[model samples]
Target: MRQQLASTFESLKVRNYRLFASGQVVSLVGRWMQIIAIDWLVLEMSGDSGTALGFVMAIQFLPVLMLSLVGGKLADRYDKRRLLLVANIMWLILSTMLATMVVSGLATLWHIFVFAGLLGVVNALETPVRQSFVSEMVEPKLLPNALALSAATFNAARIIGPAVAGGLIALFGSGTVIAINAVAYLAPLVCLLMMASDQLHRAKTKPTDTRISEGLRYTARRPDLLLPLALMFVIGGLGFNFPITLALLAKTVFNTGPETFGILTTMLAAGALVGALASSKRRERPSSHVVMGAAAMFGILEIVVAFSPTFWAACLLLLPTGFFMIYVAQAANQRVQLGVAPQFRGRVMALYILVFLGSTPVFAPLIGWLGEVVGPRSGLWIGGVAGLLAAITAFAVRCRKRDVQISVNLRPRPQVRLIEPERPTPAEQPA
Candidate 1:
């Protein structure tokens, strides 16, 4: 069991990955704690306005939509380790500022918005760079495992962070939780500084003549990447708006408080953690078919969860919802990363992040509005339908490509096999 457990977590076998993952576990938990606090703060300050929460969320990702391409280029041009260090430092500073404002009782709605926007700027640079940086921590063969483990750690933090934040908020306030998060940024910064420079899988230096549109063009020409990205755009835009959806559900649907909200979030994270761990155990990379299938499952689950008659029932359904969600998510991530060449990884990943996150700004307000005007269930239903449509579209594209390949290869070619005569020479027969 011990050996099996170690093998299952093979990415941690790498010294660099071990250090990085450990720090990230701590940092991401803190990050999630901050997120819960911020959302609660917004709701409190804005009089439970879902639109206000949506806007804050949108502002946080707008920069990623605008500047991720440039960030990807910078990731390719600079050392990832050093770039991450700088980004972490920026995050630490920003977290501190937010903490101070809140603790001092001077934080306003505008202050939160401004801080979110600035953090969005930091994330634009950090997301793509960090995506590409994962490859440097482990061997190429272990990339799938590493990526799965990375997702697992993130979801694990999701479990701990909100639970901790909810308790902290009850005992103290949002300010205290935010302050705790400010201290949490130290883990990743220290870990990055401790890594050996020579161990990193550095990209070859590229000529300065490369254009910013290079990654866009590269991704545009490949159906494998283009299809998954389209799927991500649809699902990520509407389906992944959990912060907004869950918060509204807790408030409007269940009429629950922060503690119950935290429990629901933890439930989703628990399922996601399970899915990610299962994904990590696979030795081979997942196919697009697998990705689409998982996505379809996710869509179906979302629709089911939307109609749950009670909060407990809804939470029960969210377990499998979270499971398939991570399966689809990690599968798409693995497919894209494995398909792209190393040189373009940064830029390609930027596009992936764009679809994966940036599109949220475009759809979040709409989702929030739907939740308010129609009902909280409306957002889930729309997201589910969108996910189903995206999956069906991807399936059609995959079939079309396969049919085209079959037709192209149907023409007969001359047989090149050498005949082995019964009357072969004795020397040849013996050999």
Candidate 2:
């Protein structure tokens, strides 16, 4: 078991990846803290409007849609370590400013919204760079492990950060949580600077390039990637998004406060972390079969969550729901990134981010409206059913595509005369 765990962590053997992962762990925790604090603060400040919550999420995800291509282009063109450092520094400055304003009681809903939009812009620059950076520091075989570890650590932060944020919000306020997040950005900046160039392996950047469109062309041809991307539009955009559901579950179903909501979120994160670890332990890339199965299971479990009679059960269900959901997510990401070549990885990953997150705005309002109409439970029904159908379709498509091939053969033909008798080909052909 110990050896198994060590092998799973083989990616961390690289000093550069180790530093990046460690700092990201710290930074992700801060980010999660801010996420929870902001959600709770919004609920309190605005009387728990579902539309407002969705709108906030829309602002954050909106930029990811518009700039993912540009972000992808940048990731392929520039030094990713430097890009990440700059984004973190920007976040630090913005977070500090927000903290000061909130602490001084000068913060308003519009203030939070505007700052949230700015953070969205920062992530537009950061997400693709961060996603592509791992390959620079690790071998091809080690990449799945690296991505899995990244997801696991990120999920672990989700578990701890929200719970801690809840307590901090209870003890102090959202301002302190924001301040802590600002300070935490320094950890990643330092890690980025400390990463050794010797440990890096960047793809050759073209001094003059038109290859951004080439990445899109490649993805356009790959069914394995295309199908997963399409399903992500369904699952991530419609079924898998948790923010709108979180507000409804907290305010309406559970009748709980921010503290309880945070606990539920933490439990969900714990489940997702477990899923990440389990996926990382596998020796091979999970097939589309695995990805679809996890997605289907996630949808079913979500229904179980909707029908749960009490807050504790709902909290418990969140773990399994998150576990399966993230299992599918990481599997899909690993397949898409690894299946593409190093030269095209940045744009490929950018599309992955866009497909995975870009549709949230379109679906969030629709789902929020469902919550308002038939209730939160009904909204889960839509999510569960749609997600299951998407997964099943993806699975079938991949299975059908297996064993496909085109035959080619080269054989010497009897010398044939051109514009002459078949027997008189000595002069006409290579007799």
Candidate 3:
């Protein structure tokens, strides 16, 4: 057991990764806290209008869809640590502004929207740089372990942060929680400054390319990269709007407040943490089949949660749902990063981010509107169906490609004998 545990956490042995990962854990928890607080705050300000909440969510991610290509180019051209430091400082400033507004009783719905939009801009710059930075922090062979451990850290924070935020919101209001998140941004900033810059494996600098469409062109030439990204677009865009769906579930369907909402998110995060740990322990790289299977399971579980008769039952259902969600997402993440060339890692990963997160702007509001119209359960059904269909489509394409290869092989008539070459005698070898 001890051996297994050590292997799962082996990435921490790298001094740079350890510093980055440790800082991320603290920063992510605070980020999640702010996320929950924002959701609840929107609900409070908008009188539980799912549409309003969706609008807030959409504005936050819209910039990624629009400017992430540029962000990716910048990541490739510049130092990731420096970029991350700037982003963190921006977040700290924004969070402070948000807290001040809320505390001073001047915050309105538009204030939340503006803050979310500005934060989204920071994310557009931060995410792809951070994603690609993992490769530089550890050896190529340990990349999978490092990525998995990062996911584990993220989900573990998801588990604790929302629950704590829920309690804090109940006690101190959203302003105080936002203030705490503002303070949390300093952890990563300090960690970045403390990192041994000389020890980092910096990517070879490439000539700057101002053409934002180059990344899209690169992805178009590689089906391996394209397929996983398509799956991500579907699952991420349509199926991963849990903030809207889960928030509605707590406020509308369950008739509960921040406390119960936190519990629900915490349950989801617990399952995600478990899944991430399992991914970290795997000896082999996760294949596309694994990603598809996890996506299918994620969809099915969302359907189950949709029909759950009680809030507790729904919470229980989300545990497995969360597990498969991260499994699919992280598996796809590993698949892309491992296959991509170093020169294109930033740009390809930016496209990956574009699909995985940029799509959120288009879908969040739709999901929210669905919840507002037919019912909150309707959004879950839509999301689940999208996931299920994405898995099926990927599988069908894989089988078709296999069938085409089999047909060609069957027509070939090579009758070569399969024999091992004679081993060289010991005396025949060069001294």
Candidate 4:
């Protein structure tokens, strides 16, 4: 048990990662609080219009879709720590501005949209650099654990942030929450400043002539890389719009306020926390089958949550929904990061971020519109269906590529299994 615990948190033994993780824990909690506040503020301002919320989300992620690749190129050529410091400073400034606007009662929906877009631009640059920076902070063997622990920190914040924000919003209003988040940015900035640069496993800087197209071409040739990227693109574009979906569901379906919404979000985060911790125990990169299987399970759970009869039931269901969601993500991320060449890590991860998050710009508004037109539960239904289809498609394509057969048996406790192609005897060889 002691050895297992040590292996799970092995990355934290690295001083740089320990510092980075410590600062990130504080900062991410604030960030998640800010997200909850922003979603709530949008709902209150827009008279609970899911479409408006979706539009804001779209604006926020548009820059990620457009500029993440460029950000990746910059990461490849520059110092990631310095880049992240700059990004966090910008975040502090922006969050402060938004807080002041809100507190002064001068904020409009357009003001929120503008700020969201600006933050999105910063995120485009920060995300890829941040994702690839894990490798620089720890040894190669510890990469998977580091990534998983990083996710655990995010989800832990997810669990804490919303619960705290919900209560804070109830008492002091969202402006205060926003202001607090602005202050939280200082933690990471200070952490970055204090990091010992000599300790980083920094990749040698690439030449200025390195092109974004090179990353694309490299990904095109590797099936191992392609499968996870493809899954992320499909599932990410269609299935992962929780901010818009959950807020709308709470307001329209349950007729609840920020507190209940926070509870719902927290439940999902709780499951995600469990998933991240579980993933941290894995010493090796996960297989393609594991990634797809988790996705399928997540989809099924989302569907179950959609059909939930009560608010508490939906909350209970979100736990497993969140688990599969993060499990698939972590598995796919480990696969891509482990498979890529070091020089291409930033660019390839940018593509991963592009597909996983950048696609939000295209899908967020659509899901929001669907919630308004179809039903409050429509987003979950659509997400679940998309996940199921994406997983099934990936499985079919993989089996065909390997010349393998697949079988399903239902009579004796349902099971689906892959059957490998048989190898020929030595006599059949061309000797």
Candidate 5:
């Protein structure tokens, strides 16, 4: 048990990762709080209009779709730590500006939309750099663990942030929550400043002329990488619009307020946190089968939650939904990061973030419109169907490419297995 525990959290033994994780714990909680506050504020301003809320969400991620590739290239070319420092500083400024506008009663829906766009621009640049920087903080052997723990940190914040934000919003206001997030940015900024540059595992080949197109070509050539990326794009674009979906569900479907919204979001995060920790115990890169299976389960759970008869049932269902959600994501992430060459990590991860997040702009508004038109549950089931289809499609393609055969048997309690293709003997070879 002790050995397992140690392995699960082995990355914390590194000083750089320890500091980074500590700062992230504080910073990510604040970010989640700000997310709750922003969603509530938008709902309040627009009178619970899902379309308006979706528009803001779309604007916030549009820059990621447009500019994340450039950000990835910049990460490959420059110092990642310094790039992160700059990004955090920009986040601080933007959070502060939004807080000031809200506190002074000058904030409007349009102002929030504009700020969301600006924040999106910063995120486009920051996300890939920060993701690639994890490789710098830990050894290659610890990369998978570090990635899982990073996700655990984010989901841990997800568990705490919304609950706290709900209470604060009920007591103080959205402005106060935003201001607190602004202050929270200082934790990461200070941590970055205090990091030991000498301890970093800097990449030996820092290619200054790495093109985004090269990363694309690299991914295209590798079916292993392509499979997960394709699955992520479909599931991520359609299945992961939780903010809008949950918010609309809370307000319109359940006739609840921010506190209920917080609870619902917290339930999802709690399950996600568990999933991340469970993944942290893994030493090897996840298999494609594992990724696909998780995606299928995630899709199935979302569909179940869509038809939940009561608010509490939905919240309860969200727990398993969140687990499969993070599990598939982490599995896909490990698959990509582990398979790619070191030189292309940044640009390829940028493509990962692009598919995972940048596609949000295209889908958020559509989900929101669905929420407005078809009913809130439509958003959930639609995403669920997309995820299920994506998983099935990717799995079939992988099996066909690898000449693998799958068989299922129901006589012995329903078993399924894959059979590897037999290789031809040298005597029978044409050559």
Candidate 6:
């Protein structure tokens, strides 16, 4: 346990990555604060249209579906550090504009929605770049540790961001809190500029004859890679990780104050941070079966979370729910990265990002509307159903594959023990 603890901070031994880690910890907290602020702001502005609130969430992620391929290509083609620097700068500008609107007392729901979409665009481009950047920041052996550390940093922010946002909103209002979040963007930007440039890995993008189809073709041919990718989209992307549900529950079913809402998110984050920390210490990438099993378990927990009668119960349940959700997500991620060939990694991963992040647009509104019409519990039930279904399907796919492999193993071979008539004739001839 002590060794794992020591090794988990392995990435931070790299001076540059350590610096980057610190900035993101602060920045992610701000991002979480922005999330709570926006969700609550839109819910307040629109009354209680669960579907509308989900739309607000969906629109933010729409860019992932639309632009993630380009983002991946760009990440592969450009200097990741520079791209992040630019993206952070853009976020700062957008956030400051949001702040300006707040200060002028002219902010509206559209402003939040529009900025949310803008942030999504930045994220679609930025995330792939971010994922790929860790390898550059550390030695190959420490890469997993770096990845673990990064997840830990994000989860830590998750733990802190909501509680702070809730208190800030309760005390001051959402506007100044948003402005503070905007200022927070600068931390990452400054960190990016200061990082050691020579240490980063620069991926060379081969100018492709088939640029558009490249990412798709890579996945179509490899089942080991494709199956998990598909499962992740179904389970992780479309079914699990229901922020829309979180928004709806906080606003409608609970009819609670911001502090209570913050507590809910904080609990989820607490679980997530723990999950991240635990997974980070693992010496090897977990198997697909583990990932799928965890994915299914997450759904079951969501169903449990759905029936909770009180805030603390729901909050307590969120811990395990979050732990499983990220495990499903990160497990799939580690498998895909380790499974694929490096040459096709850029676009193949582009598709992975497309499925992983892109599915938000298609389902966010659906889940939100489910919560709206059926009540908050509906999302937990429907989302749980969707998650369990995906897991069962993945299990079936695994079973069918095993059955095929066994059939092949048991298949008839060239005769070894018997050729009775011919052999008798040969023996007679020899006699």
Separate clash counts for every candidate:
0, 0, 0, 0, 0, 0
- Compute each candidate's TM-score over C-alphas: 0.92, 0.90, 0.92, 0.95, 0.95, 0.90
lDDT of 4 by residue, 1-431 (tens): 99988887899999999999999999999999999999999999998999999999999899988999989998888899999999999999999999999999999999999999999999999999999999999988888899999999999999999999999999999999999999999999999999999999976656565589998988887888888998998788778889888998888999988998899999999999999999998877688889999989988898888889999999999998999889999999998998888888899999999999988899999999999999989999899999998999999998787777878999878899867768622221100
Report the CA-based lDDT of candidate 4 relative to the real structure.
0.91
User: Which is the better candidate, 1 or 5, if ranked by TM-score?
Assistant: 5
lDDT of the structure predicted as candidate 2 = 0.82
lDDT values for all models: 0.86, 0.82, 0.89, 0.91, 0.92, 0.77
Query: Which pairs clash in model 6?
Result: none
Using lDDT, give the best candidate's number: 5
Off by over 4 Å in 4: 204-209, 407-419, 422-431
Candidate 5 wrongly placed segments (more than 4 Å): 405-420, 424-431
lDDT of 5 by residue, 144-248 (tens): 999999999999999999999999999999999999999999999999999999999997768866999998887787777878888998888889999999998
lDDT of 4 at 256: 87
Tell me how far the alpha carbon of residue 390 in candidate 4 is from the true structure, in angstroms, after superposition. Answer: 0.5
Which run of 10 residues does model 3 get worst, by summed lDDT?
A: 422-431
Taking every candidate in turn, the Cα RMSD to the unseen true structure, in Å, is: 8.1, 10.0, 6.9, 3.7, 3.4, 8.5
What order do you get sorting by TM-score, best first?
A: 5, 4, 3, 1, 2, 6
lDDT by residue (tens digit), candidate 1, 1-431: 99778877999888899889988999999999999999989989998888898899999999989999888898778888899999989999999999999999999999999999998999998999988899988888899889999999999999899989888987888988988888998999999988988887776565464467877787877777887888898999989888888888988899988887788888888899999988888766677788899889899888887888899998898899889888899999988888888878888898999989989999998998888888988888789889998898888776554542222233486434433444543321100
Q: Please write out the lDDT profile of model 3 over residues 104-203, one tens digit for every residue.
A: 9899999999999999999998899999899899888889999999999999999999999999999999999999999999999999999998888886
